[model samples]
Target: MITRSVQTVQTNPDDIIDIRQKIAGSWQEILSQAVTNPQELLDILGLDQALLPGAVVGSQQFQLQVPHTYIARIRKGDPNDPLLRQVLPIGEEMVITPGFSFDPLGEKPKNSHRGILHKYQGRLLLMPTQLCGVNCRFCFRRHFPYEENTLNREEWLSAFDYIRSDTSVTEVILSGGDPLALNDNRLAWVVEELAKIPHLRRLRIHTRFPVVIPQRITKELLNWLTGTRLQPVMVIHCNHPDEVDADVADAMKLLRDHGVQLLNQSALLKGVNDDADVLIELSERLFSCGVMPYYLHLLDKVQGAAHFEVDEQRARQIMSGMSDQCSGYLIPRLARENAGASGKVVIAPLYSLKI
Candidate 1:
């Protein structure tokens, strides 16, 4: 079981005010004032001083950036909070594990263009921004060279030209730190440009914006997302049931009403939603919010996140447990991504006891 330090400190008043101010505004406003300091995050949650040293160390590798809106869902003073575990940096991150690397997915080599990753046939990734509202500790792209990949206006046109050149490319995936991190005006222009491509049939957005900052689902965002002729599909990243609150539900409903196909994908973290009960409830909660359960991903073996990994045998066992209780449609496919593999490999759960 995951545990934390015993020493606790009083919540800082200035921190409270800063968080409150960030909480009450447009999504951009909230994101702009995101809690970046490790001390500030620990202070806000009333966590122990023991966590600060490791957090400081981890944040140095990849800066801590959590929106106040998302922090609102975490349980104050509890070190074992599932939602907190996803964002909190820890001492284990320093441990050097074999088979773990900076570019685990081998995305660096596949980055064919400035912002394009054409790993698979028929579909290509178009990264528009290098920003995310909340940075999950286990993100595979934590060490990705965003500076090299982020596109300018001319570069975006170059990317479109590449897509047009490849007539086989039918789908364009908007990925990044998170594509929704870009403002609607820029996003709409990107979509409009994509729509101009004769071969493109769908626009898939992989984002955590709606989950972390519900207010990001604005009227203008919806207008562009649905206005284009290309079919819009959004795959949101949510690991636990608590992540999907009433506000998240409303954001999802807005998307569904706008005809966006909603699906969810989660990393199977050791202490966060690794149990069968939590996974079952998460599926039910997602269904209530109009999103279908999609992929339950095995942790990507990134350098700093080996602590979050659940080995395949254990993952299969947990999925088998979920299979026993949940209906077929509610259960997500258990999948893993390999660097050179054509696509995600689906792993079927253990169904019967061996002799």
Candidate 2:
């Protein structure tokens, strides 16, 4: 049995329990819940063998940890479901490839300052927290050096200094495991520090917490988010339409109501939402909920995520189908991030065969 500290709890366990209690303290509520134990989560998704190889005994006893909010959102009895796709670890494809690496983005090399990743011009990525509600199997940053990237108060202040020193930077992006994973107090402090930098005009937060764990969107979170000096933009990650339920809708509405511009970036995963119909519905749902469909990203060529990759030709076809059905606004930019590239490259559809 592998023993570890409970600090790795995805969503705050106490907060999750409290939210469940507040909604209704019923056994049915508890039973219908998604994987609360880590082992059970692995079993439901069939990730035990993939994650921990050669470890058979006491594996069943291991409790798979799933946050109550994320659990509440999952459709029952469907293991291959799209909502389950993001969190569940399948088999390891990491061993097969040599090129697929831990830091494909070269984030460590670009770490100009503490908590700051200055890879491109005019924008900087700040790593505020090293935690996320659900660990996506295809995450490019899954192997990121979270322990090394953590910033202390002085280090955080120094990051602001780095930003202020660079006159070209206009945008500051908060990202890590997920910026929303940090408590309101910590987040607000970071925001306040960034606000001090006169050149940093826009603040962008990339997070999946609001979609996966809606309870994290407390009123206090909204207040601090909206009250900030920088123009706040929240890019939420949601791939499928089914992922958007009433609770998620409420959270999105709250963010929108508070003058936080909302956008969505989705990855094209194999079992998740590869179909044109699924993509169309997801875009429509996002538009209806006051979020602009920003970018439909091709899966990053990570090792274990080879299962999720759809080839360029098929992706282009899907994009073309989406264009014919949905309004132009609803059609997201089909793009891919080339390693060491300045910005995401938009992949245009092929016109005709030239044999």
Overall lDDT per candidate, in order of appearance: 0.90, 0.74
The lowest-lDDT stretch of 10 consecutive residues in candidate 2 is 54-63
TM-score per prediction, in order, is 0.92, 0.83
Across 204-245, the per-residue lDDT of candidate 2 in tens digits comes to 999987787776777667767888889999999999998888
TM-score of 2: 0.83
Model 1 over residues 189-268: C-alpha lDDT tens digits?
A: 99999999999999999999999998888778888999999999999999999999877887887788789999999999
Q: Which residue pairs show backbone clashes in model 2?
A: 37-63, 37-64, 37-65, 38-63, 38-64, 38-65, 39-63, 39-64
- Candidate with best lDDT: 1
- Candidate 2, residue 229: Cα displacement in angstroms equals 2.1
RMSD per model, one decimal: 9.4, 10.4
lDDT of 2: 0.74
Our model 2 lands, by Cα RMSD against the true structure, at 10.4
